[model samples]
Target: MKLPALLRRRAEPAEVGGVARLDRRTKNLTKRLHPGEVAIIHHSDLDRVSAEALVASGAGVVVNAVRSVSGRYPNLGPSILLEAGIPLIDDVGEDVFTLVTEGDRLVVDGDRLLDTEGAVVVSGTLVTTDVLEEQLEQARAGLSDQIDAFTLNTMTYLREEKELLLEGVGVPEIRTKIDGRHVLIVVRGYNYRGDLDVLRPYISEYKPLLIGVDGGADALLEAGYKPNMIIGDMDSCSDAALQSGAELVVHAYRDGRAPGVERVESLGLSAVVFPVLGTSEDAAMLLADSYGARLLVAVGTHYSLVEFLDKGREGMASTFLTRLRVGSKLVDAKGVSRIYRSQVKGWHLALLVLSGVVALVTALAMTDVGGAVGDLLLARLRDLAYWIKELLT
Candidate 1:
C-alpha cells in the first residue's frame, strides 16, 4: 500500500526552528505548549480535545512516542492536525522520552529526530487522514469489544457507588454560599478553553460561584477569570492559583490520605480536605446541589464513553452516577450561555452607558453649583459671539 506525498511530509534539508516541549500526559503538555515549538508527547490514541488544544497552541510539529491513532474508535485528533497541515510523527519509541530533555532544540525532518548535538535520537511514521480513516475502518470492526468493555465499566461504577447515587450520602460541606445562585463547575477537559470563551458574558453578568477542578483553576486564570473555589488533587494546580485567595478544597481518597493536602500545607495555605468517592468534579457538583444552588452549569464535562476512555478510566461509573445524581439542576456551559444571551447584549451595554450619562447631566442641571457653572458657560458663549461679530466687522 502506498500513500500520496501530500499525505506524508518529506524531510526538509534546512535546519528549522523548534524547541522540544515534552510531556507524557497530553493534557499537561497542552497547558505548557507555545507556538512554533515541537511537542514531544507519549499520548497513545490521542483524543480530539488534546489534538485541538495542540493545534490551537500552534505547535509546529508533534513527535509521539506512541501511536497517535491506534485504529481505536475513530479518534479524530490525527485527522484534525492533518486538515490543519500539522505534522504528527507517530510511535517514535519510549526511549525518546529520556533522550529528549525539556528546552532541548531538535530538528524534525519527516520520520527523523535530530538533537541539537547532531544525534538522531528518535524517528517514526507520519500520519494523515487517509491513513487514519483506513485504520479507523479496521478498528470499527472491533467496536463490539469496546462496547462490552464500556458496559462492564458502567455496571461496576453503578454497583460500587449505589449508595451515593440512590441515597445522596457522603456529600461534602462547603463555606461558599450556593443556595439560590448559579454555580459553575469547570474541568480541564476537551474544548474547555473555547467553551469558557463563549461563556465569558454569562460569567460577567451572572457572576456564578466559580469552581475549578485541579488544572481547571489554571484554565480559569488563563482565561482572565478568578475561581471562587478550587477543588482537586494538588498534582496539577499551579501554586499561584492556590494563593490567588480562592477557597481551596483538596480531593482525597475515602481513607483520608490526601497527597494534595500535603502540598497545600507545604505551600503554607490552609485548604479544606474533602475525602470523598469518585473524582473532584463529582464532589464539586454534589457540593453545589447540597448547598442549594438554583442551577449548576458545567464546563469541560465528559459524557461519552470515548471521552471517559480518554481520561484513562476503565469505566466512568463515578462520573456517570454523579451525573445521574446531579440531574435537574445541571446544564452545559453552551446551553446556559445561550439562555443568558437573551438578557445580556452589546446594545444593552451601550444603552446603560448612555442612560448613565443622561442621569449625570440631569443631576448636574438641578444642583446649585451646576446652575452657577451653567450661567458662566452661557455668558462665555455670548461673549464669544460678540467677539466673532467684532472680528467680522
Candidate 2:
C-alpha cells in the first residue's frame, strides 16, 4: 500500500521538454494536441474520458491550472495519465494561461516550469497515482454532497425548463421527412461505438433517419454513414461533418444568441437555428418526436444517475423532461441490441422446406425404397391429372 499524496516523499525535479498548447477547455485542447506536445489545461476534477483523450494524443506532460484529482470523486483521469507515463503538474494557477503563449517551448522539471530563457515561469505540485488514488477515496465520501448539489441544480433546471415538460416541441420544418418513420439519434457518449456496432443490423434494415448531435456527427461519419441531419451547438463537430451536405441545425440560446451559427455561415454553409433549453440529445429526440416519427432510437444516450454524474452533468432536468415527452416512442439502442435476434423470413422457411423435399427425392432416387416412392408419387400425379381432365370434360 502506497502512502497518501500528503505522506508520500516529494519527487525530485526531472526534465521534460515540449511546445505548450494552453486552453481553458480541455476538450478544445485535446482536439489541437499534436504528438509529444505538452498540454496546459484548466480542467478541474478531470474525468476519465478527458484523460483517455489526452493519453491517446500522446501528450508528453500536462500542466494543470486547477486540481486534476480534487477529491470530488474517484476520477480516473489523473491516474490514467500517470499510468500511461505522462507527467502531470497540478495547481499551476490561472495566470499560467496568460503568461504562456501557444507553441512556446517550455520545460517541466518535476513541478518547476522553466521558459526558453531558463527563467522559472511558474511552479506546481507534481501528481502521482498514489496521491490521486488516496484523493479518490476521500472523494467517495463527498458523494452525498455531490448528490445534493445535483438535486438542487436539477430542481432549478426544472423550474427554468418547464416548457419542455408541458409543450411537446416547436421543431422546425426540415427537408428530411420523419413522419411515421424510425429516427436514430446518435451521441458521442460511453460505449457509443459498441452500441452502434450492435445496432448495425437494425440500422441496415430500418434505414432510419440518422440525426447526429454535435460530435455525434463525427462518430456517425467514422462509422461510414452520413447523417441525414446534424444538430447541436456545433462546437465539438468537425468541418468535414459540417460540409458533408447534411442539413445542419444550430442549437441556440433561448434568447436567440447562437455562437456556432457564425462559424457555419462563415464557412459558406447554411444552418437552421434552434433555441431550446436542453442537451443536444434532448433536442434530437424532441425534433424527431415533433416531426411525428414512429419510433426513436437513441445511441450512446446517458440515462442512468451515475452515468450523468460521470458525464459531469450538474442536473438532468432536460433529459428527464425530454424523456417524459418522448418516452413512449424512445428506445435505447444498446438495450434493444442485447435482446435483438434475427427474425426468420417467409422465404427462409420456404427455402428450408424446398431443400428438405429435394433431399428426400435425391435419397429416394439413390435406393430401391426411394425408387418405389418416386414411382408412387409419379402415379399419384398422373391420377390427379386424369381426375382433373375428367372434371373438365
Best candidate, lDDT-wise? 2
Tens-place lDDT per residue, model 2, 211-312, is 999988999999999999999999988999999989999988777789999999989999988877777788888888887899999997887655566666
* Maximum-TM-score candidate: 1
**What TM-score does each of the candidates earn?**
0.77, 0.76
Candidate 2, residue 240: the lDDT equals: 98
lDDT of 1 by residue, 267-351 (tens): 8998888776678888788777877889998998877766766665564557777787879888876334344435578998999
Q: List ranges where model 2 is wrong by over 4 Å.
A: 1-14, 116-119, 313-315, 334-393
In model 1, the runs with Cα more than 4 Å from the true position are: 1-17, 116-119, 335-393
Error of 2 at 132 (Å): 0.9
lDDT of 1 at 269: 90
